[model samples]
Target: MPKKAKAHASRQITLSELVTIQAGYPFRGSIQENPDGDVKAVQPRDISDLGELSADKLITTNLTGKRKADWLQQGDILFISKGIRHFACYVPEDMPETTLAPSLFLLRVKPEYQGQLNPEFLTWQINQAPVQRYFDNSAEGSRQLNIRKPILAAAPIAVPDIETQNTIARLYAASLRENALLHRLIHNRQQQLNAIANDLISHS
Candidate 1:
């Protein structure tokens, strides 16, 4: 008989165990058209497919001091709870003070487990294809799939050693930077093509 490969030892934990998941604030009333409003609220539309936040699309809100806790902080991971497409984005330290819309979930690592789990790693893992498929399968709603808090909490995660987690997170960040550069190159080339086409049309 052939020898079977042994599975690597790893700690498996439910997402809920590693982090505290909270639903985003449900902002009432219309968004302020003024860019200088008190708060910048992040909506589902502001999340890109690559789990990047589009700063230009964020809408301003009029939230007061009483709702200060509702504001997202650096290292906070925002997960799209409801929608056909899901995204998980890490809030950068340089991001302006912002609030989350109702359709998103804010995931923060438990204080005790912060050293064990990397925030960027968790975000990247949740956006992985397997995890995304899990969300798609568990989501509810007839018209549009909606991932509830419980569903997200129940998702499984592999907790590897801290060193491995850090390595993977660094690689993931590098990949994101590479992709962004590629996107910019493509966009610039397309603009050049458009300009050439316009010039040729004028000459003709």
Candidate 2:
């Protein structure tokens, strides 16, 4: 309807067409945390509601299996497969030697589509209202909803031109930073107010 809305490329494609999706490392039993562990483990809690991954909070664990670990790479997308919030997060370039828990699905752009598709754009698209609605509707389970790989692979993504995608992704990232700053400011102001009130009460 709007001019800007029509600006995006009309080529709507399924997610599977552009990327290879793989479930995260299938570590048996609970991951044992080690103070001097070799690798960082990304759990669902490590991802923020705004779709940003908090790398610092990731627990370090000594990976134990004989199988080679599928280490997370730059430009990979992490999708929360099981949870009430099925959002996708972009892995930044400066990530630690990390592997995620099985609760996430790792998406890497296929070799052919590498330059054509931007990982940040894909993450933003998957977390968009329309795509999230698709996941919400398709998710199974009464208490804790789980998004199947098929449902995620079949999710429709509007593939705009590279320029548009990059612009959108950058803007989304900037917005997330602004949101975080605002929340921090609010929290600090609340703390200041509490301190002032406590001081006044003590003096009274």
Candidate 3:
């Protein structure tokens, strides 16, 4: 753990104790692009490397009563359990009624532990380099690495006071927003340069 993380560690608890972690429902049918479908499904690709959701790739489907428990809610976190790189995405309040794909693990803070653990903080913590490394090491499979439920359940998380957790989560969110703006700015600049180059070439 880094010095800053160590300083924040007022107490330690297994991830499972703080949040209920369960694998997503396995949808036997294909993920169709039905905007009018009853339910939206969040696939692994829908989560970006920065832990933000990309709605462009989200697919809609009809979920049955048995899978209602998989419905995502605000403050819920989705973990990419299978893949070369793992990502943790925090669900936002404005997201439509959505459910996770089979490749993800739904992380919901236990009601009793909700006051003690902030969902944003837990999601940010899991995305941290140290915790990511732990997941990387625990991941199984030669071609496609997959994190098992037991490994995630046993992983330790540092829990600071509620105030500190909120502050950290706020800072993390600000950084992500800043990063997104920077990316857009860079893309615009690149497009302008490409357009100018093409105009100059045409004139020459």
Candidate 4:
């Protein structure tokens, strides 16, 4: 008979063993602007429901020089840490190039050397509930659980074949497009309703 599958692999990798990021940046909301074009700031609320660096709420600040420069960009992934209790999250959508303002760990996928990991899949994996629990277990501080890059990378992870990873990434990309479409539809409907209400009030 063929060799049966083992109950478990003799070895397993952890999260902290994945990539390289020492710690996450925690951008507070207080530093965030209230949505005027003149200000410059970012906050967790700026993270769209779809997990992306959504449109930002600008705030008053003299944040210039190098600080004024290194903003966010499209296709960049960021990890949200701090202030929140014990959960791992990411900005799912791509922001305009040069819009950095969140306390998030900017993730750059060196595609040339990710082994068998699709960066998109990894994004989902990290934000996964089970994986979040791993971080929770390793949390150090009292209120905010801090996990350094080493520990974050050492977390256990099992990746499938590259073909499979690519397949998952394709699906994920499709889903993201769908989500954006849905959002646009909703927004258009809301606009229509508001216009109708305004007309009725004005005509009355």
Give stretches of model 3 more than 4 Å off. 1-6, 64-66, 94-96
Which residue runs of candidate 2 sit more than 4 Å off their true CA positions?
Answer: 1-6, 94-96
lDDT of 1 at 40: 83
Question: How many angstroms is residue 148 displaced in model 4 relative to the true structure, after the best TM-score fit?
Answer: 5.6
lDDT of 2 by residue, 1-204 (tens): 655655555599999999999998888878889989989889899899999888878888987766677788899999999978898999987565799888999999999987889899899999999999998889999989999999999999998889998998899999999999999999999999999999999999
lDDT of each: 0.83, 0.89, 0.85, 0.55
Candidate 3 contains a number of clashing pairs equal to: 0
Q: Estimate each model's TM-score.
A: 0.89, 0.93, 0.90, 0.61
- Arrange candidates by lDDT, highest first: which order? 2, 3, 1, 4
Global lDDT of model 3 = 0.85
The superposed Cα distance between candidate 3 and the true structure at residue 175, in angstroms, equals 0.5
RMSD value for candidate 4: 6.2
Q: Give the TM-score of candidate 3.
A: 0.90
Judged by whole-model lDDT over C-alpha atoms, candidate 2 comes out at 0.89
lDDT by residue (tens digit), candidate 4, 96-136: 43344444455555555466556666666666677778778
User: Measured by C-alpha RMSD in angstroms, how accurate is candidate 1?
Assistant: 3.1
Better of 3 and 4 by lDDT: 3
Q: Number of clashes in every candidate structure?
A: 0, 0, 0, 30
TM-score for model 1? Answer: 0.89
